[model samples]
Target: MWVDRADWNCCGEPFRIGSQVTWELRRDIDVRWLMEALGSDTAVSVDAFQYHHGDTDVASEQTSGTVARIRAVHWRSAPQTGTVPGSGVLTELNEADRGAPDRGDLTFEGFLVTLKQ
Candidate 1:
């Protein structure tokens, strides 16, 4: 679902929900911020500033073959009510949250990109 600005004009269909996407990193962003956005049910928007190299605008420099962008989408999940609404049956939760298997070893690689406005 990653569309460069140059290709955006050619796209006919609108972006839909639940579509996972990845794009370049236009500006510096914190990984925590991205994680928070993903966890939330609302859409978060941020502005992207055009970079400059010497007297030339880096964003318009497609000749260098380097353009930065970010990947993100608005996600919605069923509300967490702790149990089924009608039925009285309880739902099982993730084992990781219960400290079953210690898979806490997590690492994030690559730069955290943000969606450009």
Candidate 2:
């Protein structure tokens, strides 16, 4: 499931293996040397930063960029959560479900993304 914690959550559309996606950076990221390091057509894995949760330090609009190519696909799975192995499945909690006491430990998903400026 998506990164659902007291700190942040996912608020964007779900992506697929070949989907082009864009997201904001949690902090300043230096990708100036990416093309040189991985070549123009090469796709590299990077983190899809967390969604803002009203924390002034982790705002959603910090840094955003153009859509980037999905170089390859990798799935994140957990046996307990019964997630599809290598599917990278993530869930976004509805506002009402944010702090439900019945909600116990939840699985989280991480993304490796490329950034296009």
Candidate 3:
């Protein structure tokens, strides 16, 4: 999960930089593959960005026209079972940047946190 400093009400919590915000993967893309494809300092298309209310399990709210920045990429697994079910990455974005021109194209800034399950 992640939080937007400007859209605290949307998240239903106080604004905190780098906070976790709920995200939904629209496609079945490998996190490692996506990280490699994006590389470092490369802009990525925000078309894949889908946001939702943090308090709900069902994806009923969708935030459109936003940008994303890849923060980190790592693999996660259950140490006890040695089962690697999924991986996650963090991304950051500005609430004001939403609906801006070219918002649907690519983004070079903001924060992000992504999880693949």
Candidate 4:
């Protein structure tokens, strides 16, 4: 799942910014759907960045980009278990430079992306 500040058209109705959109990772390289959601038709770059130690401890660094800031929201399956699954979120974007958001009880790893015409 991903929450973005853009409209998405991959799953029938368009999901606007802040809407959680779910997408399956295919072979870990299929990102066409995500690019489309960001309203891009050309090439885009996606890079992975780590910003947290676990579900409780957090440490983030500042980053800038031309497209989107992809952050991973990680959480545990149960209260007694450790951190497990993760989802992505689209944060500050389009030439904006910012640091990772505060993840109080969840882990956030992120990516800095750029779009090309």
Q: Best-fitting candidate, measured by lDDT?
A: 2
Instruction: For model 1, state the Cα shift of residue 81 in Å.
Output: 51
Candidate 4 clashes: the total is 0
Per-residue lDDT of 14-116 in model 1, one digit per residue for the tens?
3322323332223332233334433322113332222323333333322222223333222222257422222211112211111112122322111212322
Q: How many backbone clashes does candidate 3 have?
A: 14
Per-candidate RMSD vs. true structure? 16.0, 10.8, 13.9, 14.5
Question: Residue by residue across 1-117, what tens digits does model 2's lDDT show?
Answer: 112334332354544434444544454334333333333342233333445445566545544444343222223334665444233322332222232232133333233344455
Single out the weakest 10-residue window by summed lDDT for candidate 3.
99-108
Q: Estimated TM-score per prediction?
A: 0.19, 0.33, 0.22, 0.26
Clashes in each model (backbone N, CA, C under 3 Å)? 1, 4, 14, 0
Ranking of predictions according to TM-score: 2, 4, 3, 1
lDDT of 4 by residue, 1-117 (tens): 232222121122322224443332111244454453333322144332222222333333333223323332223233543324232234543332233454564433323333221
What TM-score does prediction 1 earn? 0.19
Top-TM-score candidate index: 2
- Which structure is stronger by lDDT: 2 or 3? 2
lDDT per residue as tens, model 3, 19-109: 3444443332223434443443332432243333343544334433222332422333345743233333334333322322223323222
